[model samples]
Target: MYGLEQYLLSMIYHYRYWGLFTVLSFGMIGVPVPDEFIMAFSGFQTSIGHMNFVKTLFFASLGSFVGMNLSYWIGRSLGIPFLHRIAPFLHMNENKIRRAEGWFQRFGDRLIVIGYFFPGFRHFVAYFSGMSELNYARYTILSGIGALLWSTTFITLGNLLGTHWQGIIALLHRYLSRGGIILALFVGIIYLYTSNRNKAKTHEE
Candidate 1:
């Protein structure tokens, strides 16, 4: 993963749009790739005259929409039972699934728009939304808006930063990676803590 990030960073320094699009597409489709960093670095590249902001944003959004739709279709076709078989490996739990389903039920469709900004929630929300049999047209609309917003925001940031964009991106990559590791550790700790608590409570009962 680290090597890939370095490779991407190098690519962004050269072919900004291609690098950004590739990273975002793969990342959205559940690859352990750094999509955010790619956007930020692409923005940095723009500052240095290697990229166009509008084009970068367009391609980034397009890639995200395509990748997410693919995942949605997979989940929709395979259904929940198949998803359950792969859930553990993906760190998806029943509680998370239920929560996503609940969100879909309440929102009817808005979750797709909102979910785009929320990491860890975005990918599964699409799948669960599909499983809920959300209208394809509506899903497309909401997801498209979300993708547009996310892509525009990051790419614009890159454009604005310009030359110093690389430094900013490097710092962000370090922090984002650290943050992901911390989040993973936190989830593990919470799972263990809850399990121990439940066992104790069960004994008392």
Candidate 2:
């Protein structure tokens, strides 16, 4: 992974603009790429006069919007059949799907905004939002706000921390590396608790 990071960093150094766009787009599509790192790198690059902050933010946000929409369309078109096919390997059950759907329905548009901050749920929310056929205008509005917030935060962090950027980059990388593990544990706990509650309800029934 370190080598991959180095390689990507090198690419960013050489092909800066396109590299940033490609990385951001792919990351939003559920690819295991360090999108945040690219944004931060762009920030550092901008600080050093290699790139422009406004352009970097625009491209990053555009890529995110495109990638998210693609995921949303895929979920809308594929629906439950696609999910069921992948469920066994993922160990996801119908109850979990139902629960997620319920939650999405209850929260509605708010989920899209918050989901952007949640690594595991980001891609899923896009699709779920589509499945729910959420208002396109509302989804776009909420999602755009999310994209702006997330992109600006990291990019600005990179710009402000320019010279000492390495430290912040290291901190971010550590957080990203462990983020999925933490989310997995949280999801597991939620699933187990929900499952037990469901079982008890069934027994009562």
Most lDDT-accurate candidate: 2
Model 1 RMSD in Å is: 5.9
What's the lDDT of the predicted structure labeled candidate 1? 0.72
Reference-based TM-score of each model: 0.70, 0.78
Put down candidate 1 lDDT per residue, 23-98, tens digits, no spaces.
7777787887667667877766666767777888888898889878877787689776776788799898986655
Can you tell me which runs of candidate 2 are displaced by over 4 Å?
92-96, 176-205
> Which candidate tops TM-score?
2
Which lDDT value does model 2 have at 43? 87
User: What lDDT is reached at residue 177 by model 2?
Assistant: 52
**Model 2, residue 139: C-alpha shift (Å):** 2.1
lDDT to native, each model: 0.72, 0.76
C-alpha lDDT of residue 183 in model 1: 54
Per-residue lDDT tens digits for candidate 2, residues 1-205, read 6777788878877887777777777788788777777778788889999988998888878778777888777777887667778878978788776765655565656657656665666887788788766777888888888888878877888999998777887787677557756764665576567667877999999
Query: Where in model 1 is the C-alpha error above 4 Å?
Result: 84-103, 163-205
Evaluate residue 140 in candidate 2 and report its C-alpha lDDT on the 0 to 100 scale.
84
